[model samples]
Target: MIIDIIGDIHGYADKLIGLLTQLGYQHNGQCFMPPKGHRALFIGDLIDRGPQQIKTLDIVFAMLDADVADAVMGNHEYNALAFATLDPEHAENYLREHNETHTRQHEAFLAEVPFGSERHHYWLKRFCEIPLWLETDSACFVHACWDVDSMAILKPLLTRDNCLTPQALTLTSKKHTPMFDALERVLKGVETPLPKGIVMVDKEGTTRSRVRVRWWLDDLDNRPIREIARAPHSAIAQIPLDTKAEPIDFTLKTDKPIFVGHYWLTGTPTPLSTQVVCTDYSAAVDSGYLTCYQLDTECPLPLSPNNFVQYRHT
Candidate 1:
């Protein structure tokens, strides 16, 4: 089967359209129809830090509803859902993070997402249960980085978890709350803070954002600088290299293809062992283009968000 995996969209629906065209994904109205058995998968971060957030939601939700695509949640989406309880000021600020001119638009989008009936539900429902690791006997897909044996531990979790049903695992085993509940809190004006000692760091080791990105550390994906340098792009910024605690060690359990994202890849699309792959080119920011890859064919095509078309007006 030809599996098409897409990296972070970050509200760039128009840009995604261009990439879809290049990837040969045909369209019907606002929905898309992939070639038979040519399914699509998303690496999440479906909202925030960009314009047209709702449009992004509309397209992905439509595609998934149409059974043309599958998706996994990203940190941003997690934050959005979490902010749903952060009172008015925080909620407004969260909306402002992406320069959302219409808060109601965001409100509507969040309301439409299906978080599902699962207890112990840490992670969003719709895409959250898609499994951190996807594996066919011949392939696998993960969103972030891993080491020599990271895939080994992942296969069982995915298989035992059965990411196929998506809804099959109501309460995600990730030891966290689902995005739906968290977002409800934000909209309700609840205060949610970053993890302890996770103060953002800069080149000179200074704090930057109010929040942090260290979930992988708890997921057993951490390593010391000495150990990390062995991996490709270990020194890449936004990688959260300098942390006190670390995550558990992992191993690749299968000889299948693993498509993943989360880390912003700049130069080349490095494959760990012909089975592991990353698609995130950090599309939502000023850094570079969004990316998508065909699992069966193994092709990466870069895309450009077309907000520039409206830049002159702003």
Candidate 2:
């Protein structure tokens, strides 16, 4: 089957529809129909960070109901669930604390789908239907890093279809547990500690001592932190190397192709490695493009850049 692995939508409905149309999906007053023998696979983060939140959800659900599309749960979607779920131990608080930072990051989605409204509850139910990861005979689709170790730990806790069970959700919502760590690693990717006394400030001005790493790199253990980091090299190029750093052994060992999103990658879309691809191209930001990696599931490994399709707008 031909699968179109779509990146994070982040409420950019217009860009999403543009990419869909370009991929030959025709809208029939409701859902978009994919070309024969083709289907769309979303890597999640379908809501928040953009203007058309409701429209974007509607489009995706319509296609899902039409059986032309499937999706995995993203970190944002997981956060939404936690935000809505009241803490059993402390009823006044939520599973996701309503602190300033969390609220600010979630305000856009909450603004569109008011908390406790029928629409909000409905979407949350739909979100529950989304699995945490999907695996076919030849490929795997996840929101972020597809760490085999994490998946093994998470397997039984998840539902039969790999979705979060209520118990699993609760376990994952709380920090410090094996479940939480596994969920975080898969949904948010892996991070490595920076050298002592070195830190980098993110766009939001938050100082970070650890950096997200390219987990798919076979030689990640041998690379410099700047080169191994997922962020721009120039951002951390000046930091002194941590010569005593412990080796990081988080590389993917599979020969089967894996597709993931969640990283706000810039520039032209390309296969991250011979067997791995990151579909996210910062679609939620201005000057960013909505992208997808078109794949024939039966095709050989070592994906090519030519298959990267995008909806670009200045």
Candidate 3:
């Protein structure tokens, strides 16, 4: 029942492979399945801005197909899927512009994705159903924030937003479209009323559907990202304007453990607030490396002196 949570891959398949290999995976000739009782969890962003997008997806999809791994749909994956549905023209142009050997490999990887298949949908239902705030028997996992009142409250919201009926969750349906399309619209909106934040750009490098919201839930008065932060990444990390913000930005409560990977810090972990911790060490930035956290305390690696590190098996 041990969980080996991974961070964003961003198309670095070789690193993922190396890391997985170092973690003691057994290749069944089709995919690398974890040793019995070990489970892998992906934090998403499996593709884009890397040399081996296809290979990355191939590894992920293979592990996923083999039921040895679980993945949460990342904002990037949401963006790509939304791009396919909302703005095919721009998406195609984007593909043409950045599409390379890796893209071709990625294409083949996705070709056999079997997105809405029974088993895939079942996993998708469970994954998409995970809350923005996750609480495990041993730790907590979240892609970005630990906002909602607690994991209990976050579960329903996550489930409602992510999980859907087989038909509703299909990539072809409109119901599911909005699940990811909201990001597109947020990224596309041309009007930046906030004048101080993020202005998102579509995959096609255009701004057609744009809008913004302050941070988590402080004051989502409906503004666009452009006015929130000059840079998209900043906008993403920007704490909404409010004085009543929580003491911590939402993370380790000092009562439990927290593990996350959206900030991209590759080498070292960061303790933003007294309680909040970030594990994303920007492993996908270069060929240098990527990371995995194994939960075996009896034989843990020397990565974290802190006890709350996420788990991968190596």
Candidate 4:
């Protein structure tokens, strides 16, 4: 079977439609139909941070209903579920705090689907339906890093199809728990604390003491911080790692090729490593693109740069 691995859309419906058409999908009266023998696998983050939040979901929902596409739950989607769910112990609070930062980050989605509205509830259910990760015989697809340990921890907690259950959600919602940390790594990628007293301003303008690292790379001890971390700013990316910083002992252990999104990668779309490819290209920004990696299951391995398809901005 052939699969097109799509990246984080972040509510760019026009780019999604454009990328679909570029991939040879036809727009029938109902929805976009995949090319013969091809299916689209979205890496998620379908809502928030851009215009046309509901419209983006409408297209994805239509494709899913038609069985032409499948999706994994992005960090944003999981956050939405938490925001909508009330904490059973505290009737006044939600699983996700309604703080200024979270509200600002999620305001676009909440604006379109107001709290307690039927539409809001509808999307929340859909979010739960999206699996945390998808695995086929030849490859794996997830929103972020696909850690073996984290997957093992979450396997029994998730449903047979790998979607989240209400109990699983509640269990994973409690901060600082093993389950919570596992979920965070899977959805948001692996992060390592920077050297003491060192901080970096992220693309979102938030100061972060910990930086997301490329989990697929091994022997990072020899690599510079610019090569090991996903710091968006060049100045921050160049900082030397302090000797006191903890070493990253984990690395990708899978033989199967993995496809992931969530990192706002820039430049020409390419394979992150021989065993993995990141499809996200910062599509939510004005100059960014929506990307897809064309994969043929019959010969899936050692992903190449030639198969990347980027949305052409007209």
Candidate 4 lDDT: 0.88
Ranking by TM-score: 4, 2, 1, 3
Where model 2 places Cα greater than 4 Å from the true spot, the runs are 233-238, 241-245
User: lDDT tens digits, residues 200-223, model 3?
Assistant: 453235432233322322333343
Clashing pairs in 4: none
Off by over 4 Å in 3: 87-135, 149-255, 270-277, 296-314
C-alpha lDDT of all candidate models, in order: 0.49, 0.88, 0.48, 0.88
Worst 10 residues of 1 by lDDT: 305-314
Candidate 2 accuracy as TM-score: 0.95
* Regions more than 4 Å wrong, model 1: 85-133, 145-248, 297-314
Residue 123, candidate 1: alpha-carbon lDDT: 26
Model 4 per-residue lDDT tens digits across residues 1-314 = 88999999998899999999999999899999998999999998999998899999999999999999999999999999998888888889999999888898999898899999999989898888899999999999999988889988988999999899988888889988989988999999887787777877765667778878788886766455666777677545546653333577566778999999998888998898889899999998978899999999999976889999999786
User: Candidate 4 — number of clashing residue pairs?
Assistant: 0
What's the true lDDT of residue 265 in model 4? 87
Models 1 onward score TM values of 0.56, 0.95, 0.54, 0.95
Local distance difference test, candidate 1: 0.49
What TM-score does model 1 achieve against the real structure? 0.56
- How far residue 55's Cα lies from its native spot in candidate 4, in Å, is 1.0
- Stretches off by above 4 angstroms in model 4 are 221-224, 234-245
